[model samples]
Target: MFRTEISMLAACALAGAAHGQNLADLSLDQLSRIEVTSVGKRLQRVADVAGSVYVITADDIRRCGATTLPEVLRLAPNLQVARVDGAQYAISARTGTDLLANKMLVLVDGRTVYSPLFSGVFWEAIEMPLDDIERIEVLSGSGGTLYGSNAFHGVINIVTRSAGETAGTLVKGAVGTSERFVTLRHGAASDAGAFRVFAKKRDAENTQRASGAPVRDASRHQLAGFRWDGGTPQRQFTGTGEVYHHRTEDVLGERDYHGAYVLGRYIEDAGGRRTQLQAYADRLVRERSRTIRNTVDTLDLELQQQQLPTAGMDLLWGAGWRLYRDDAQPASPAALDLLPRRKYLHLWNAFAQVEMEGAAASRFTLGLKAEHNAYTGLELLPTLRYSWRPSEDSNVWAAASRVVRTPARVDRDVASPPLVPNPSVRAEKADIAELGWRGRFGSGASASLTAFAHRFGQLRSFDLNGATGVFANNYGGWLRGLEGWAEWFPAQNLRLKAGMLLQHPRYDAAAGTSPQPPSVTLGNDARHLFKLGVAWDVRHNVWVDFHVRHVGRRPAPAVPSYLAADARVAWRPAPSVELSAAVRNLGEPRHVEWGAPATASLVPRSLLLQFVWWP
Candidate 1:
């Protein structure tokens, strides 16, 4: 496989040998100047960030030919993403995969979307037109000091383009063996502001089980959203809203989930000082039966400020408040249900960070945060970082941080047969250290490498007593990993990107705990992952891209290692229209990326045709 990838790259290079300029020249330049805010809570050049971070640009998204957000995220080497079925994905950073992944924090345009019920994201419920996405930043280390709780392992921040940038009409559609979807969007400028509205509908076929029998996982999605941006550069105001309905069929029967949210943000920049205020309201409803339903409502508010307190120094501070109200109803006699069906969860946090520049292109940063939650009264997170630039286009950085994950409702309030929750369960904690380097070898090539180690305490576990078990904090472990990625132009019109991950995790159950191994209870994670991609400009108007990835075997659930490949070809028949064809899971016909053997859904090779028109 490695030789095959190398041969493909060599072939692309030879094909583009006559071109004058490499396609990666401009991209490499833009990458160095790309500003990211996830690390310090303020805009900073990628080279200046003191932690491991990967940025996926808009151009990459356009060329990738992916229909869903999760598919696009595969470009980030720091992340581990697996498709569970037609409409579900298990994603994490620096760790293996989990259907109920809870440690990673995800934000869409500054709005948190993870459910408080399980402290995990319901990917099917979060949908938006892909064209509006500007960039995605994947931070592979802890962001507890600035991002507050649930940033235990990593953070994914999805930023959308400003309304003004999308001032036109766009129609997109796609047909595939596994799914079909269409989207419509229109944007215009009025006296109030620049605004755009979009609507999308999609349907997916059920996946097959290992035995070739169809599973009950088919789904349908309907989504609509709008964004409006107003005011001047010195004082900007933005408002956004979205509503969605998702329906899924499973063994239990058909279920419908509806969600809606409204958000507003105001920013003031004056005299080298910036201040931002944001607020949002969100609601989610899931209907199984007339009497069995789950509903969650949330209200969030945040304030942030950035200033150059003195020469060669930067200061940042922020505070946020969020409230989640969950009303749940048990489905049947054996379901694990939250006691006191209606309950409220409140979280408040404040954080401050300071960066000081030193001699010889070096910087030092210190950050601290204090958060108060319903389950954990108060938690303190602190971080220290240093970065040194050895050359104009290279950076060496190191960071150490403390992060905590507070207990979710499932951990503290559940009361059901064969399971019991303990309100006394403490928060899960981890101390992480990271060292990384990012540099450009030349104008046409760049690479990033990071080494990280984590020491965890009070990890989630269970204590079996007689006939039932209670949630407890009796697991601790050490996890160490190395992540590396590189992109280069071997020819003027060809670009190659590759990445790999090596992870080692060791966990031990505390004395007197259940005898089950930690891997069996805590979920299984793959130890190695590799990905390679190629983009070749076959002609001025035709482009082709190829991607191949490998995932190592998992132990607990006993899933064997697998390799998958994908390819896309795009043609621009006119300036305003594009037509493309994509094949996913190529070469490998049927394989399972997750779940137990008997019930796991098999992902099959499929092809799609897509069209986009701008008028």
Candidate 2:
């Protein structure tokens, strides 16, 4: 499955350029111009967000030396991304779980991608041309105020660029010692609107040699889409759609999935008032080596309004709903009476946030979200925050929020005798409180830091009997951590970015914890993790980046400690062609994250070479 015959190639002209100024030369004023919608779903500078967040742009993805979505996720300060063999990855932030992972809600274009089967984002199947991403917003801790449900620990928003913004003809392909990747992007504009379509394919042999080694992970994506803009920016309507497919090798067997989706939204602003409506539906098929297969279809809709009903106060509100269904395989007449499956269960939610501006240097925010789920019934999430800015250089803020982890389909099905259901499971709950600081110095540097803790109740896990797929209540646990990050680009060419994180988790009763091995340090969580990277511009058109990272160890999980680093150099040989090469995991064994001791890791040292042509 070679996308291109790979061979050693020198860095393109971008990396060949002579170095005079480094990325560190860029001042604070310059970096503030990058547009971000991660915080409030509105354009604002990165510094405006009240919590610890990171923005990974398309360029950053290329320059960071990564191949898959999991690799890109590693850039987040304390987030852990560990590969389970070739296709599966155990990913989590701050807190780790044994039976079920119910933290971290992941969204693609505002659509929830976590499976109701386990309350975790299947990190796999998030296939899209990396080049199409506008930016990735990583928000840590209790985003339940807006995202609802499993947004217990953190939130990841993967936003794509508009077809209109990417109008052009581009082809990008890559080759590596053990893998190959390629993508094609083309766009056009007409009276109806601007449209762009792209396709990507990747195949890789095992980096490590062994039968059943979890290598040979292969996947492909076919997406054809267009955005039709019908009116002005303030009053506009747009639509887009895509079809995609993905296949991966896993521990049990391979799972192939194919799907299509279409989305449309309309916005209107009149008399200082604004309103919006959006809807989308997607269908996916899951085919496993086993005889049983499943098909899932999801439908989503949203409506929102924002206005200043009274002076000095701003009000924003929105409601959303999602319907999900998984059709089971047809059975013989004898088994027709087995547990029946339903095609739909409505989840309806509404939220409103009010921001009050106070005189002098203070502001206040009050918000709440209410949702009704068939499994866990009604849930209410609330948030309260206050901020004060004494001077242009600094601002301090604090917030308290309540979040819940709604029960998933797995909570009921998979009993020991097979399809029997468990009716006693309940939702996991959490209470979070945090304080943060944002500051900018006249000397041209800025930073953000957040200190937070979470109290959990009714955590779910497999029953001690372990006889059924059913899960039951586990005693409460606690998570506390500190996250801080900063970016300094003194110049356009040279940039320095760094992040640090620390966390500790305490289980109230060590007795009944199922899979945790005896070696785990009591109450000891993952230790300190750190990240540092520097991007330098060398001469004419050459740019080079070096990144180094450290992953600490933790309990029950035999996750080994490791230090790994990656380096990349890119050159623009011509205005239309660029060449690049990168190396990953230079100094460590195959690694993984957020899994029980049984989780496997299948990775070896690897290399990647790619070419980009934009005309």
- lDDT tens string, model 1, 307-414? 956899989988999999999887763565778789998999999899999889999999999999998899999999999999988999999999998888878888
Q: Give the range where candidate 1 is weakest over 10 consecutive residues by summed lDDT.
A: 1-10
Specify the highest-TM-score model's number.
Answer: 1
Per-residue lDDT of 435-496 in model 2, one digit per residue for the tens?
99977767546777889898988766554445434455565778788888777756656677
Q: Cα RMSDs of all predictions?
A: 5.9, 6.5
* Model 2 spans with C-alpha error above 4 angstroms: 1-27, 33-35, 97-100, 190-192, 207-227, 308-310, 330-338, 416-420, 466-469, 490-492, 509-525, 589-599
Off by over 4 Å in 1: 1-25, 190-192, 288-292
lDDT of each: 0.83, 0.67
| Model 1 TM-score, 2 decimals | 0.94
Residue 44 displacement in candidate 1 (angstroms): 1.4
Candidate 1 at 429: error in angstroms?
0.2
TM-score of each prediction: 0.94, 0.88
